[model samples]
Target: MQTVPMVKQKVHQTLDTLPPQGLKELSQFLDFLKYKYQAERRTNIVALGGIWQDIPFDVTDEEVRALRRRVTDTLLSKV
Candidate 1:
């Protein structure tokens, strides 16, 4: 069985040889895989809608923007 590094190396080698159209297809496939994986792993947000109803919070637009930037950076770092 191939290890994670071996699989990644094989993927990169294949990607390097793909043409523009092949690369586009690969990108779309990867996006689909990410979406499918996330969908399967996600909780049903609607079912938990009222779980946080007791919490009170208020924030300005600047604070929200900064929080979003920080969260995005953190998530991207994991990739």
Candidate 2:
């Protein structure tokens, strides 16, 4: 993949400056963005915020956290 110059810098800057509410809004916006474009997904996994490596769903936070823990445990066992 071709790297977009200044992409990381600008993304970090924007995320860092977001207030809590803005962060929530950004999260929702990202959720929509991912869903809208998912049919065109090329890779097996899609990354977000450089660090996150999965899709964020509309499920409750508790459910999401549980899933994350499961994925972490499974990945750790594999390595």
Candidate 3:
């Protein structure tokens, strides 16, 4: 199997053979791939700890059960 160093050497050799325009396009492509990779690696989490700090939602147990029931019904209906 090709090791990391071997692969890097091959890449460097290939880069050496590329024309100026080809090198520019390859650099841009590599940058785009890096950006895409970083974007996908991120988690979709937000710290909204105080997003509605002034608002009060005094929810009851019945409300929770009712919401769950409605959600389940909607899902089952779709299925």
Cα RMSD of all models vs. native, in order, equals: 16.5, 19.5, 7.3
Model 1: CA > 4 A from native = 45-79
lDDT of all predictions:
0.90, 0.82, 0.92
- All candidates in order of lDDT, best leading: 3, 1, 2
**Candidate 2, residues 1-79: lDDT per residue as tens digits?**
5367678777888998899999999899989999979967766653466445455645799999999999999999999
1-79: candidate 1 lDDT, tens digit per residue: 9999999999999999999999999999999999999999988744324766666565699999999999999999999
What is the Cα-based lDDT of residue 78 in candidate 1?
Answer: 100
Each model's number of backbone clashes?
Answer: 0, 0, 0
Error of 3 at 1 (Å): 2.5
Query: Can you give the TM-score per candidate against the true fold?
Result: 0.56, 0.43, 0.56
Lowest lDDT 10-mer window, candidate 3? 45-54
Estimate the lDDT of model 3: 0.92
Top candidate by lDDT:
3
Q: Any residue pairs clashing in model 3, and if so which?
A: none
lDDT of 2 at 48: 60
TM-score (C-alpha) between model 3 and the true structure = 0.56
